[model samples]
Target: SQRVMETMAEDGTLPRNAVRIFWSSPGYSHCCFTSQNNLDPKLAAEIESAFLSVTDEDPIGKAVLEGEACRSFVPGTDIGWEMIEKAAEAEGLI
Candidate 1:
């Protein structure tokens, strides 16, 4: 992990070029939220709004965002993961 790499480097424990990356995803891994099918639509919208409202500038929001490795939450879209989903289904992993 990046945190472990930084800590080891600071302590002089990590060797040069210890961490190497061959490839990285173009899109970031994201957290997704969903409600039960029977849940109220208005309540779901409120929950979504609350998540979208969190910003790094707010203390509590900052802590939550840091824990999640994200600076802030943004509105999610189905289109974002459509390709990954299709690939997973093709591999019979979905």
Candidate 2:
């Protein structure tokens, strides 16, 4: 992805691909994957809602959302990494 975007910038292809080849969700800027540049507004809204629902419900999804706000995606309440670590330590894994 880095190399592709770098090539895009070097070749002045970013703008063209942005509006022509790819579309991002309004809710998430870095979430840049779309089947069509001209996705229907209604469908986009539905997709966004689905994405948000997953983010809201799943523990790992919460970590993703938090990481989106911050920087790196580290384990926390979402997925209970701390609890897992404690269990592992109890079993002498750490």
Candidate 3:
């Protein structure tokens, strides 16, 4: 899982302010925590709700549990590669 996060960071696919990716032992339950700076709490809640909705949808949770990775993108947001690299470095994942 750490390798996957590092790959995403290297590939510039990780979202802005993405702080951590956690994988559970059951191999299905996972959560991504992001930095709260410059973000609205309500919006963050909405995004988390959206993630949960998608995860709860039929077979999506199973897919996420079994699949390689789960991704989220905010339209019009530009998450530069530098941020990803920094995140990877901070986590010692690079």
> Each candidate's TM vs. the true structure?
0.65, 0.28, 0.32
Better structure of 1 and 2 per TM-score = 1
Please give, for residues 10-36, the per-residue lDDT of candidate 3 as tens digits.
888985348675554543323435644
Model 2 Cα lDDT, one tens digit per residue, 1-94: 5445766877998854463435543432343334455899899777766654655357787787765553433221233256766998999967
Alpha-carbon lDDT, every model: 0.79, 0.56, 0.59
Candidate 3 whole-model C-alpha lDDT, 0 to 1? 0.59
- What is the lDDT ranking, best to worst? 1, 3, 2
Against the true structure, candidate 2 reaches a TM-score of 0.28
Global lDDT for candidate 2?
A: 0.56
> Candidate 3, 3: how far from true, in Å?
17
| Stretches > 4 Å off in candidate 3 | 1-31, 55-57, 68-94
User: For residue 21, what is the lDDT in candidate 2?
Assistant: 31
| Predicted candidate 2, C-alpha RMSD | 17.4
The best candidate by TM-score is 1
Residue 38 C-alpha lDDT in model 1 = 87
